[model samples]
Target chain A: MKSLRTFIPIIILLVAWEAAARSGLWSRIVFPSLVNIGREFFLFIVQADAWEQIWTSLYRAFGGFALAAVVGVLLGMLMGRSQLVAGLFDPLFSGTYAVPKLALFPIFIFVFGIGSLSKVALIFLECLYPMVIMTYHGARSVNRVLVWSAENMGATRGEILRRVVIPATTPYIFAAFRVAVPVAMIVVVITEMISSADGLGYLVIYSLSSLRTDRMLAMVVVIALIGYALDKLVVLARDRLIYWEKLDTYYV
Target chain B: MPHAQRLAGAGLLLVILVAWQLAALRGLPSYLLGPLEIARHFAAALGSQELYEHAVASLLRALPGFALGTLLGITLGLAAGIARSFDELLSPLVFLTYPVPKIVMLPVFMLWFGIGDLSKILIIALACFYPTFINAYYGARATPRILVWSARNMGAGEALIFRRVVLPAALPLIFAGLRVSLALSFIVMFATEMINARSGLGHLIREAENGLRFDLMYVSLVSIAILGYAGDRLLRFSRRYFLPWEESHA
Candidate 1:
């Protein structure tokens, strides 16, 4: 029953989409039939070079994300643990938090060239803020009582940070991942769409330019699947690691 | 402690600026401009009519899309939160596609809606919708049921309860969503403009890049940055004014 409930809305949307496609009111290009899209999707997956495009996008997103994770956590940990670090860095992140970092893409392209490096760098910059802010907040708000108890047991500062602070901050780090991963995907796709010869985003633009709406839709589905899979992967990891704390909140 | 912290942050910023300027003085690349040089270009641009034209165009696209998206998200999300049938019917679809980048829909939107501002506006709306919707839904759901019961016990009406109790509780999360979507609106607006547009800061920056007009690029960059910062500040101040009883922690 639960599974059925989950699929119900999806079924409705698919039905509505098919109906629209068959309505004959609009051109086939405007609303490509699902069968056509599915065929293209199948075709896309079987093509050897298509996988390369997917790989290009995946590497850019993950590479940037991984770098940001390491740097953001370290920086956040430093800020959370040391007042001086927080004082020095907080304003930099928070003040520009509202600014669209996409503005720097032009500069990044000039510096890093029109290759994947610029996209990766942009992703890193975008993902860094969320990770730092979330991790810092998580680390800052760890129970003082727990630290006091650890101290009473004669644990060193390093031990406390490793054992308690890290575990406590893990949930928040995962929350940041939830935010960052999608953002990385968004940035990669946008950057590639703006400027790239290959990648799923490039494929979307390329197909559209050639007026192959079905192929383009197929690419969209591929990007959507990869994005959805990455999110599910993060959730699965969080569940396995943070078993003690249920993710009850809808918003992080 | 707060005073010292402010001083440290400001000091670091000053150091970075000075270092950048010194680097420029030592003959940095043509593509790079010093902070002062960039400032001078921006000041000069400020005197020209082109800056305001592009700024206005950018805001026109961003603001309307933001307003439309947030309005629909809040309304639908709050409705879903209060009613189970609507929730079960819609929640799955929303959550299912939540991770998918909405920007990919731009091509399709263009094909269907025409290659104009309408499609761009719709795409921005689509991009901004998710965060606000989810946040508002959660906010409404998180409202204390006891308060609702108390309101009923005190003979308050349904609409009154909704307006007086539910909306207030949901405002914080809604505001959180608003901030996210607001930032998102600027990004999507910039992106759509960058992808294709004759006028706007995004277009200006792209044109500058292609022409190797480094100073013009910085001028557009700085303009968007200031606009983003100002929009964020305005939203924060409004939140404080409206939700005075609630601490503005987030």
Candidate 2:
């Protein structure tokens, strides 16, 4: 019954869209019928080249995201534990936090070349902020008494970090992951749209320019599904990895 | 401790600038401008009409969209937060589509609304909506249950309780969301302009790239960076005005 409620609005939207498509008040280009879009989507998905495009985008997003995750967590942990590092870095991050790193893409294209490397680098740069910021806050705010207790118990620094600090920070790390994953996807699509020979974003642009609105909409749907799935993947991982803590306050 | 720490931070920034200047002296790449070189170019451009034209164009695209999106987001979000039926009807759609890059809708919007500032503004609004809505919803949801009960016990009406208690409680999170949305508005604005615009800093950079006007590129980059930083500072400053009782996030 609860699940059924969720479908009502979506169904209404689809129905309304189909009605508009058939209403004949507008051209077919404006409102491609859903059936046509579905057929185009199916055709696109079945192609071997389509899978390669998907892989290209996925790999680039992941390459940058993985680099960011490792570097950001380590840097964040250091900042959290050491006042010198915190004082040195916090202002830099906060001050530049609102600046759109996307603006750096033109320069990146020159330095990294007009290829996957620059896009990947940009993705890494964008994703790094959330990871570092969240992890720093989490690690800094860890219950001080827990650290004191562990110290009194004669636990080594490494042991204390592993046993207490990491456990406490895992929730934050996962939260950062949730934010960064979509960010990676957003950067990938934007970069590809701006300049790329191949990728889902390029394909969408390609279809539109050719006036294949149905095919273009199909690609949009595919991108949306992939984005939705990636977000779900993060949520699933967070739930599994951080079993002790429910997802954080921001989550529904 | 605070004084020394602040000095150390300043020292680090100074060191970075000097190192970049030295690297340029040693022949940095043609594409990469030195800090001082960029500064000179930006100062020169500051005296020109071109920079102002582009800056105004970009702001025109970004600000209206930001206003429209945030206004709608706050209204709907607050409604959803307080009303269960509204939450059930609306939230699932918002969450499901939240991760989808809203930029993809640009082409569609362009086709529908025409290839003008209107499409760009609408796309920016669409991008800005999610963060504000989610933040506002959560803020409303996080209203203290006891406060609501106490208001009701004291014979406060529903409308009065919402206006006095719920709105105030939600202000901080809504502001946080606004900050996020404001940042997003710039990003989407920049991206859209880069993708297709005759004017704006993004366009200036793209034009400079194609024309190999390295100084122009740096000038545009510097301008946008300053604008972004200034906008953030302005937002933070205004938050204090609106949220006098709340602790500042900074």
TM-score values for chain B across all models:
0.98, 0.97
TM-scores, one per candidate: 0.98, 0.98
Error of 1 at A50 (Å): 1.4
Q: Model-by-model lDDT, in order?
A: 0.92, 0.90
Off by over 4 Å in 2: A249-252
In CAPRI terms, model 1 is classed as medium
For every model in order, the fraction of real contacts preserved is 0.64, 0.56
For candidate 2, lDDT tens digit of each residue in A1-252?
A: 999999888889999999999999878998999999999999999999999999999999999999999999999999899889987888788888889999999999999999999999999999999889988988998999999999999999999999999999889888888888888999999999999998988888888899899998998998899999998898888887888776454421
Q: Which candidate is the best by lDDT?
A: 1
Model 1: what is its DockQ?
A: 0.71
Least accurate stretch of 10 residues (summed lDDT) in model 1 chain B?
B241-250
Q: Write the per-residue lDDT of candidate 1 for residues B1-250, one digit (tens) a residue.
A: 4999989998989999999999999999898999999999999999999999999999999999999999999999999998898899878889889989899999989998888889989999998899899998999998999999999999999999999999999999999899999999999999999999999999999999999999999999999999999999999999999999987765
Clashes of each: 0, 0
